[model samples]
Target: MAEKVVMAMSGGVDSSVGAYLLKKQGYDVIGVTMQIWQDEKRCDIEDKGGCCGLSAVEDARKVCADLDIPFYVFNFKQIFKDKVINYFIDEYYLGRTPNPCIACNKHVKWEALLARALFMEAQYIATGHYAKITELKNGRYALQMDFNNPKDQTYALYGLTQFQLKHTLMPLSGIEKDEVRSIAKEIGLKVFNKPDSQEICFISDNNYGGFIEEEGGKKILPGNFVNTDGDIIGKHKGIVHYTVGQRKGLGIAFGKPMFVKEINPLTNEVVLSENKELFSEGLMASDINYMAVESVKEPMEAYAKIRYSHKPVLSEITAQGENILCKFKESQRAVTPGQAAVFYDKDGNILCGGVIERAV
Candidate 1:
């Protein structure tokens, strides 16, 4: 009997084509769309650059019908709210910027969906994430960057557990983004040209502050903008409206250029300094998940990515008590708290990752 695979179709060209690819690979593919959007009209589906909406369900259903495969809609709204949305609000409230997509991929996509697939007797769950799963020489599963795919997603996916990686399938690991689109087009998929989802899917206008207030039921209060010396320079908007290294929208003008150097949730202070102060030699991270190894007993050479858009930098990794320390060879800029710090080996295999707690 063929192995059963659940393909997560997000109604985009990548995942749509991913479903087609899985079927052609001789697996019994079942198409599934995660219903993460709320019942109320919180976002514009057509304008969404990412995924999740009524349209996503219909699109996935169409793709499954075309492939002669079964389709299902999984109600993941409660879990999403608990794991992704609430976590986002809590982090911002605590004066740290959070990546909801990363949280969604970990809690919703893998943890929740993988559990559901297993209950249904499915052998594996798959997504169109532009990453490759590989077993290291140490017999541990880890994610590798697909250099062929321009939109590499290994950063957001570094938190995947070993079990999740073992049971997950990425059919597009070696496929380029353009080729995925071409396959969708050749197969007559309507989402072949659909725009990719960019901003937070639930936040249409990207007003994170307003969304946090509405959903979190707490208003983000105004705070003080302070210099590195602890002197208050100006009154500013709420802390949630700003992040480390933010220069624009400060609504205050110093004599020269200035940037957000840090944020203190305890005192509700948004620290400002010259652009140079944003650079840091190292960062302290917590809640780390190891991928290619069981643990890091000593400092090791690796490449560290502080955020999604950042190019990886040469770094040394060490375990400091329950947290991890990433000391970069060259000082990096805007080492923000609440963002992920993903460490990769020399060959670009994910070593481990953790939530950045603070810059050292």
Candidate 2:
């Protein structure tokens, strides 16, 4: 008998194609869609970018029908609100930025969805994530870099544990985005030409401050903007409205352009400084998950990316008990707290990653 594989279909072209590929591989393919949130209209079908949205479930259903597979919709709204959305709000409230996608992948897709797949007797759980898993000779699983486009590689997947990597499948790991779209078109999938969801699904607009204010029910008070010398130059709408390295929307006209150096939540102050202050030589991180190797007992040389869009820079990483220290070869700019710092080997294998604690 063929092994049963459950595919998390998001009603997107990539996941739709993933379902097709699994069925063609002769596996007992089962398509599962997670209903994670209720829409503003309280309708079963909404256009929200969340995977659990009604439209996505319908899309997955359509693909499953075409593939002659069974379809299931699991409601994960309460879990999503407690784990992902609440965590995001708490992080922002604490004056730290959080990546909801990372939390969603860690807690929702891997933990919750995988559990559901197992309950259904699935041998493997697959997704459209552009990542690869390799079994090494040492009898360990390694999450390798995607072969499609280096720029599109999601090194954030370093958080994946060996157990999860063992049963996880990424169909789009080797195929480029263009080719995936082409395949979807050839297969006559409805979402073949659909644009990728870029914004945080819960937030209809990108107004994070507005979301916080509406949810928290606390009006952000106006505060003073001070320079490095402790001189107040202008007034800011609120500390929550600014972030490190923010240049525009300051609403102040200085002789030269000034950028947000830091936000002091304690004092409700937004500090403006010259661009030079934004660059830092090193950082301390915690809440780390090491995948490629067992643990880092000493300092090891590797490439590190401070932000998602930034290129990886040469760095030496030292494990300090529960914390890790990353010393960059060159000064990196705007190393924001709460963002993850992912390490990689020269060959692009994910070493590990953690949340930024502080920058030096």
Return the top candidate by TM-score.
1
Q: Which stretches of candidate 2 lie over 4 Å from their true place?
A: 40-50, 147-153
lDDT of model number 1: 0.90
RMSD of each: 1.1, 2.2
Residue-level lDDT tens digits of model 1 in 35-111 = 99854266667777457888878878998898789999999999999999999999999999999999999999999
For 35-75, candidate 2 gives per-residue lDDT tens digits of 88757443223444445577778878998898789999888
lDDT of 1 at 238: 93
Against the correct fold, how does model 2 do in TM-score?
A: 0.94
Candidate 1 segments exceeding 4 Å error: none
| Clash-forming residue pairs, model 1 | 49-196, 49-197, 49-198, 50-197
How far off is residue 283 in model 2, in Å?
Answer: 0.9
Error in Å for residue 294 of model 1:
1.0
Clashing pairs in 2: none
